[model samples]
Target: MSEQLPAPDPARFPALDADPSWVLSVPEGTLIARIFRAGGTHPVAWHEFRTFGPLDGRFDPHPLPVGEHEGAGVLYGVLERGRGGGVADGGALGGAFAAALLEVFQAQRMIRLRDGSPTLAAFEVTRPLRLLDLSDSDWIAVAGGNSAISSGDRERSRVWARAIAQRYPELDGVVSASSLVPDARVVALWAGAADALPRYPAALLPLGRDELIGVIDRIADRYGYLVL
Candidate 1:
C-alpha cells in the first residue's frame, strides 16, 4: 500500500485560516499559501505556489474537484519575475504550480485528449515586480498557444478551458494573446480594461492566424472577439 503522507503540523504548517499566510517547502518544491477574502460561503480562499509540465512527463496533475461553489470556474496561471532566467528562481515555481494544477485537473476529471495525450500546455509564469505578486493581480497571461496553433492542436486548449471553468467560477472572462491587438484591446476595454480580463499581457502576442487561433482554442471557455 502507498504510504500515507505525514500529517501537517499546525505550528509549522498551520491550517489555512481567515487571511492566513504561510510558506511550505518540499525537497525541490516550495509552496506559499495565502488566504484571501472568501468569495462565498467558504470562509477562506487559497493560492498556491507550484509548477506544471506536459502530461507525458513524470509529474501528475493536482486534484481540484468541481463543485457548485461560487469561485469554481476561475483558471490560475503563474507570473514569473526576477533578474535571472533560470528555472531555479521563478521558473521552478511555475513548474510546481503547473504540477499542482494538473492534480486539480485529474481530480475533476477534466482532461480531454485529441491524439491520445493530455490536452494541456505548460507555461512559465512571470511578473513585472516579484513573481509572488501574481496573487495580487486581477489578471494573468497564459503564453504558448502559437506553437499549438501552428500544429492545429485543440486538445490542450479544450482541457484548459474546461478545467478553468470547473475550478474558478469567479473568472469573468479570458483574453487571448492571439486576438488582433486592436480587437483584444477593445475586449479588454469592454471588460473594464486588462485588469478585468482573467489574464494579463506579459509576452509579445503570437503572430499569424493559426497561432492566434491556437491560443483561443486552448482557452475556448471565453468569448472570442474577431478583429475583422
Candidate 2:
C-alpha cells in the first residue's frame, strides 16, 4: 500500500487572524507563461473568475463567497524571470515553460501532449499586480504558515487559501515557488485581474504546433520525462 504522508502541523498553517503583508509586485510587461486547454474554462486570454470550485488545486478558493469576494477570479502562470530570454525570444528553453509543463503533467511519467490540444500562451502583465508572496520562507512564517502551504495536501492547503482570501481580500492572488520546480515562481491571480491580460496574448500556439514540437521535446528530454 502507498504510504500516507503525514499532514503538516496544524499549528503552522496560516492563522485565520494573522495579518500578513508579504505581497510581491509583478510589474507591467512581465511575461507570464501558461499551458491551458484551448476549449476549457480558461481559454487563451481568460481568467477563471466565474467559477469557484470544490476542485483540487492547492489554492483554488472553495465556496468563493458572495458580496465583496464575488467574481474574484484566478489566473495561474509561471513568471518568465529566467535569464537568456523567454519562449518568444528565439524559442529559447525557459524555466517558466518547463515549470508550467511540469505543473500540469507531473502525475504521469509520460506526458501525452496531443490529448488535450494543450496550448501554450504567453501573457504580458499590463499593470503592476500585488500578490501574496508565499514563496519566501520569512513570509510564510509571518503568516504563521510553513513551506507546506506550497507543497502540501491540496484540501488542507485550500483551507489556508480560504483564510488568506478572507483576511486579505485586496490581494490579487498568491505567488509561490513551483512545487515541481522550486526555482521557477508561479502565480495565481484573484480579484478579477483580467485587465492585466492584454486583449491578445503576446504569443499563443498549441503544443502540437510544428514550431513548438522541438521545444516540447527539449523540455521533456531535459527533465527526463517521456513525451508521447
Candidate 3:
C-alpha cells in the first residue's frame, strides 16, 4: 500500500484563499438520504467530534480541547433527487442505494442486516444551505488543498476540514465526491445547521424488513457482495 499522507499543518499549509463564488447552495426543501442506525444517534443529529484518526470521518470536526476550538458537529448524506426505487443499467444498482450500500459495507463487502439494524432515512432541509464545494478543483486549489480533500487519506482530509471550518465559519458544511462512488456526491453538514433538518425523516426503511431483503439480495447479486 502507498504511504499515507501526513496531516496538513496549520502553520505551514498554504493560506485559505477562498472566493464567495465557490460556495454551493442547496435549496430549501432538498431531500438528503442517509443510511444510519435507528438505535444510534438520531438521523438529524449532528455527530459530535470525539476522535481523531484515519478511521474518523473526512469532514468531522477536529477533536481539540473543548475550549481550544469551536465545538462542531457533522452530518453525512446524499441528495435524494435520483434515488428512485428502480435498478438501472439492467442489473447494476444506481443512485443513493448503491452509494450508501457500497459506502456502509465497503470494508466487509457483506451486508449485515441485524447489526445495528441499519436503516435508510430521507429528510428535507428546512432552509437553504451554503456549502463549500470541494468537488470543484478550482475550489480545492483556493482552499489550499487538492483532490485529496475528496479521495486521499482521511486523516489529512480531516485536517483540511479543520482549516476550512476555521476560515469559513459562515458555511453550513461542504460537498465532495464520494470516494467509493465515482458518479455520486456526498454532503457533510456542520452541527450549527441543525435547524435545517426536519423533526422526522420523510422516508424510512429498515434494511432488516422482509420486504427490503429482495432488494438487498439483488444488490448482492450485482456486486458480488455477501448478505448476512
Taking the tens digit of each residue's C-alpha lDDT, what string does model 2 give over 1-228?
Answer: 422223334445454235445677778988888878766544443334534563666777656443334565556788877546665343323668878898988887576776756878887889988788887636666545677778876777777777676666776788898888898888887655777777787777787777667777877888888988
Q: Write the per-residue lDDT of candidate 3 for residues 1-228, one digit (tens) a residue.
A: 554545555554333344555777889987776777656443222223223222367787655543334447676887654534533331212366667777778778999887776877667889999888878546666434567678877777877887777777888888888888767778888866778888776767788887667777887888789999
* Of 1 and 3, the candidate ranking higher by lDDT: 3
What TM-score would each prediction reach against the true structure?
Answer: 0.22, 0.81, 0.79
Better of 2 and 3 by lDDT: 2
Model 2 TM-score on a 0 to 1 scale? 0.81
After superposing candidate 2 on the true structure, give the runs of residues whose Cα lies further than 4 Å from its correct spot.
Answer: 1-21, 40-50, 64-70, 88-93
lDDT of each residue in 131-177, candidate 1, tens digit only: 11111222222211222211123334434433433333333323232
Query: Using TM-score as the measure, which candidate wins?
Result: 2
Runs with alpha carbons beyond 4 Å of true place in candidate 1: 5-21, 24-68, 78-82, 86-199, 204-228
Q: State in Å the error of residue 115, model 1.
A: 7.7
Give the range where candidate 2 is weakest over 10 consecutive residues by summed lDDT. Answer: 1-10
Best-fitting candidate, scored by lDDT: 2
Give the root-mean-square deviation of each candidate in angstroms: 17.6, 4.6, 4.5
Angstrom error at residue 96, model 3: 1.4
Higher TM-score: candidate 2 or 3? 2
